[model samples]
Target chain A: MTISEIVKDILSKAEIKNIFFVACGGSRAACWPAKFFLETEAKHMATTLFTSNEFVHATPVSCNDHSIVVACSLRGTPETVEALRVGRERGAYTVAFTGDPAFLGDPDYALARAGKYMVPYRNSDKLSCLEGNSVKLFQFAVELLHQAEGYSGYQDVQKGLTVLDDVIAAARQKAGPLAQKFVNAYERKDTIYVIGSGPSFGTAYAFSICSLMEISWIHSPTVHAGEYFHGPFETTGPDLPVLLLKNEGATRALDERADRFLAQYDGGHQVLDAQELCMDAIPEKVRGYFNGFVLGSVLSDYLNLLGKARRHDRSVRRYMWQVAY
Target chain B: MTISEIVKDILSKAEIKNIFFVACGGSRAACWPAKFFLETEAKHMATTLFTSNEFVHATPVSCNDHSIVVACSLRGTPETVEALRVGRERGAYTVAFTGDPAFLGDPDYALARAGKYMVPYRNSDKLSCLEGNSVKLFQFAVELLHQAEGYSGYQDVQKGLTVLDDVIAAARQKAGPLAQKFVNAYERKDTIYVIGSGPSFGTAYAFSICSLMEISWIHSPTVHAGEYFHGPFETTGPDLPVLLLKNEGATRALDERADRFLAQYDGGHQVLDAQELCMDAIPEKVRGYFNGFVLGSVLSDYLNLLGKARRHDRSVRRYMWQVAY
Candidate 1:
């Protein structure tokens, strides 16, 4: 079934009073946009995003038959599978986004097929994480909002989805040269503070841990732009390498505030404002929602360049999947 | 009014459908236990924790007359005051936990008196953050649970609270020597990864950003223990400095897993297990709930010793209140 059809059918049968977005790492970060969208748009419906194991260990008291649990894993993460199982046990309408059945049949994915509704998203040699994971999960949210509330932004979301690929391409092209410049100047720097706010903070978080740390072996820590002044801003210095992202969201002012602070205190900092991306193709009404897509794509460009300059393969890992973690 | 009396009065007049815990920095971290408690025990009411600015910028759609907004700050953070004002404008019942009225009357706190209900919490020369902030916030939660749901664990919570002070003192004594050893060995290291899960994660977060970074000028980033294996564990190595906290909550296994990995791969990591703390005075049933209090007190010892060793006064700051963004 199409995402719309699946959501419509589920809405017809169950009164989903709450949503639990469960995953880990990048997938957990990806859950942010959907949770933010629902929190902002969906009245009377509560939503939460949780790390998979935390979800399983301390399952929300509200996770009942009336809850919808969306669990994501690129290749059947064990905790995600268990989290889905826990959701199912609680009689929640459970959805899983994972690799193909053939991949799930591997020993590593022994219990991956736990979702009541399995939505297979491919992960191959190439990196299509944004397209495969975040976009698909967001489609679920869009479909849910449409079917449940006759959300007026449905058309805007559809238009955004249609032009999103082109927007991502444009962003990648625009960011490529800038990323190369960044790599040339700051190639030896070990620590970078990646900052953003609202929905864009998800991308900043993903880039810091998944890309900079895991992929490029750089010590990058994420700080929410709104949260920067609270405590993390104290660590800022003249030589601090800060990568700040700005998006045209309601919380854009927070990101701009952090950017302004970094501009004053930090010399080795870069600002990747979503305004620089060619998002004219996306509808103006919903451009804010698609900023994550643009930011994720552009940050991927930066990470790829940094990885290449440091002679590190993005796929290379010393502990992940190789060791019995 | 006392916390119990205040919660009782609030409950008497209105039916609160949801709770929003709004704050920034350490105050925001203090909201976790209350939010966690509601998520775990409250069957119908929903709860969310938000950074104050984000709460103001993208207010939740559910913030209606039936919503309870609990805003926290030591001396009225500007964003927090704005957040409470937004909550009040939305017709939600607004509560504030700020400093005494005299301190709040200063020019810096011009807009601090935004909440419909103001609860004074003190911040004197000594460090009483856990007591003045987290403990008070948690009292509101405990009273809320007892009043709203007639929670059977009320007596356990009461017993736990009665012994919490002693538990904290015992934890401090036990942790002081270990912290001195830790400071002697790893004081020069600039980066430390602080890890925890469940409610205890709040303490880890507070210690990392508020104590380590803001107070001691050390580079510390927080990682949830459940989130460690997903991507962050890849960044762990032999020479890395890791400060891991373990609690008796349902998510303790996650912390133990991260602790095991650190033990094997890193020799410099220090583990502060709640089980080691003298929590025997607290009720056995609610011991897990007070682990955060014990952990916070013990971690404060570590941070204090480290601050002394580095010759960095905990009060020293380059940008906090000295500069404007």
Candidate 2:
């Protein structure tokens, strides 16, 4: 059976009430898009995203037989695998998304016990272009909602996913030259502040950590636009590197407010608004659903340019895969 | 009625299944400690912390009459006030924690409608000490848990709160000279990474934003220790300034792991361990409960020193109080 069929079969048997997206590092970051999808489409289902270690230590009472735990790890790190095992022990319907099914070893043994699928990507070493992982996760989420009884709008979401390639192409075309310009101007900056709101907040966070800090070795922190004014705005100055991502949603006003604030400061500030991209394929009502994907795609292109400019290899790591904690 | 009595009364009336601790910026960071406490002591209660704007826009389906919304804002900002109003409208029991009863305007009109109480503190402008707000929030959480009928160990929590003054004094005594030294070394640095896990994560976040960024105009981002090696550790070097807060809890191992990684680099790294401070008044069994408070107090002292060294007044802000977003 295909991954979707397996998930459907599992869901059909379980009386799941809560869902947890669990992983560590970039794996955890990759879960954010799916998290946003669940929040938007399946709000009735209590959903949460937790780092693998934290989840293991502070295992919520909700993580029982009535819960579904969806986790992803590119290399199937020990911590993440342990978390999935713990979830299974607690009687949760465990689902794993991974690039290398064999990386965890005893794949057949694990699959027999919990649902597992391999992410359709060959170059697992590269940090850029998480579109494949994100696509699979979002598809799984939409399928889960569709299989569930009360959830609405999954049909629109499935339709949108079918045409996401066109959206990605358009976002890349607009982001290419701008990414080069941004990379050239701020490649040497000592620090940067990346701001976003709503769905784009996860993209901002992932880009700052997975791309800027990990790939380019830059000091970048992602701040929520809605909360930017409360404290972080004080760090703004003429020399600060600020990157703002504006999404087309009800939370757009919050990003606009941050933009207005940054306009007063004579700093190196850039705003990547989702409305600027030509997402003609996605329906107007469902465009909000793809904000994270579109913004993340554009930011991923910018990060690729940054890696090229800084002479940093996206796959190179000092301690992540090298040393044991 | 006293705040504790009012909270107990409110708890008695509500059939809450889940709880949301909502606010924006520093206020949101403030809710995290209480959120952690709830997770530790009352695992049966589903709890979450969200930014006020996000809560307003993507109001969760679980946020109905079966939910309790607890929020805090020093001045009761517009976003927070709106969130509280929305919670009340949704029939969720709403509680507000603020330094001033009139800060939200028309105490009789607002508090009379939603349960509101003033945090015991004067000089609300001072950003250095958030003890009053933290104390009130944890106290409210403990009292709520105590009145919930099934939760255990509320008596120990209450006893610890009674002797918190001793903990605060001891933490300050140890933090004062160390704070001066840390500020003198890193006050001029371009950026810093504040790392913590578990209960200390909120303090790391709040100190980096509320004190370092807002008051001293420093660039710092709080990184969760469990997730630190996954990405941000790649940015570490001899010159990088890293501050780690070690809590005496199940998550302390995560912080120790980060400390070991930082040791390989000659970065201006510092660790403020809660166990290092002499807290004779706090019982050994309950020391974990006050880890957030102890670490936050010490870090706040360091921020105060940094503000003094940098000649930055904590109350002075370009936009927060002076202008609107």
Candidate 3:
């Protein structure tokens, strides 16, 4: 059977009344759709399940013949493989998906999802779950929405994929509108802090590693911006470089003036405004998030690069986040 | 002058051209109205901005004399206060509002928008921002909008707030329906994870601390349900309890399934099927967030209480966040 057909089979299967779909970061994104699919499919049950890292350790009980661990990973993260291993150990059925079966072995449902390298570090492994293999993991589950208990509406599981893709594409275009400015603001600064809220918070978490700490090896810290005002502000000074997620979600007056009000001795500041309206304006549902984030990412990328370009900046933690532990 | 009038004073005097507001976790919920306010106030030249903890520290560079730091904190967290302090030291005028002034002075613009309390910890402080502060922040900014640059239209701003408040209030009622279930879920789990996205993320962040972690002392973890599927899934098990924020702006599929699929584990689960339609169901605007979070928080409180009552389980984390330094 094709990927969708297999997903449909899993959707129709009469097992695991309460199912939890797990995955790695890649699967994490796909879990979005997987969630819709499972919930929509199993709406009739008391509840359908989905979780990632936190759940594996917490482990919610209640299992039956249907209880199984269906995990996904584009690269087959150790977490996914381990989850499947645990599922089998627990007498639950397990299905693992990956670009290569080598990660889990032949019996594991390692879907041939990987593609050629899109760039140097990035691989264009386009998994065909939906728009992107990432989307597919969830979309495939969404396609099973018809099976979820009490689920009434036949939600066009693919309703907004195209739009989302467009949005993401558009956002990616403007990825870092204020990268240089952030560096310029804190010319002599030694540390960088990235603040975000909601969905952007996750982006902020990854951004710090990729944008500055990873590339330039700068000591950057990510926080839930609201927490900064709680008490962390005392140490902030010209030495701290502040970058605000200018996404159009929850940040407004806080992001704008929060930095401006900092004491003159406070670190430098900038706003990476990836306004969501522009993100919401994507034509096709598929590009939605890509467009929304692309532009802001560009700006973010620039800030990290700008610091490296300056060369004279010696305070950069050459091995930021490079923990020996 | 009223807070609105004072905002106008600052905008005109500061010659503020662009403004961005920075908030954290739950308080970041203000981003919605703050954005509306800045755009309205500037007429054209100045736009609004919002960022979470991660972004504020990494990539914000755009600024002008008009720049100000408007920090929000109910608890006066160290990082946030320090961030604000950093802003002030950087020569940016700082305005802060908190439930407790132990670390801060009284609010001249608004006298402690809300009061301090321990039962709810700093959760009530976040409520203060949600109820009227966020809207007022927007309205105050709107009053400044006229000929600042080249923008006009308090119409959009007002409408947004009106709709936002009403929707938020209505959604707040979920606390009533889910309160008992929340408590019940908490009773059984060893660890609790609050999963959310978009505006709901802040709300979820608050629940993790106040409900499960702070008050109840449950081992609660807050995660972007979508992102949790990545690496965090390693933490899951049959006893983990989870709360899924069923708001529209989340990474849809993933969040919806979080509660139910999580239920399968028998660890524990609560589904806060909060819809935007329920936002206006709130009795008082000020009490909106407080009321909204009640059911879920109460559940967390109940769970924490139950665990302690049994002396069988311990709370999630000793501290909300590790100092990490």
Candidates arranged by lDDT, highest first = 1, 2, 3
lDDT of each: 0.81, 0.74, 0.45
The number of residue pairs in model 3 that clash at the backbone is 226
Which tens-of-lDDT digit does each residue in A127-202 have in candidate 3?
2213334454444444444444323433322445545545544554555334455656654554466765533554
Regarding TM-score, does 1 or 2 come out ahead? 1
Give each model a TM-score.
0.95, 0.91, 0.41
Q: For residues A1-325, write the lDDT of model 2, one tens digit per residue.
A: 5557866777778866778887877777767777876765564566788888878776776688878888776656666777788888898888877654444333444322443433332222233333456667777777776677445676677677777767777788987887887887798886778998777787888888888888877888789888888788988877579889998866788888888888887346887888887766777666776888788777877987787778887778876667765
- Model 2: how far residue A38 lies from native, Å: 2.8
Provide the global lDDT of candidate 1 against the true structure. Answer: 0.81
Q: Which ten residues in a row have the lowest lDDT in candidate 2 chain A?
A: A121-130
Q: Rank the candidates by TM-score, best first.
A: 1, 2, 3
Residue A62 C-alpha lDDT in model 3 = 37
What C-alpha lDDT, on a 0 to 100 scale, does residue A83 get in candidate 2? 78
Worst 10 residues of 3 chain A by lDDT: A113-122
Instruction: Tell me the number of clashing residue pairs for each predicted model.
Output: 0, 0, 226
Number of the top-ranking candidate, with lDDT as the measure: 1
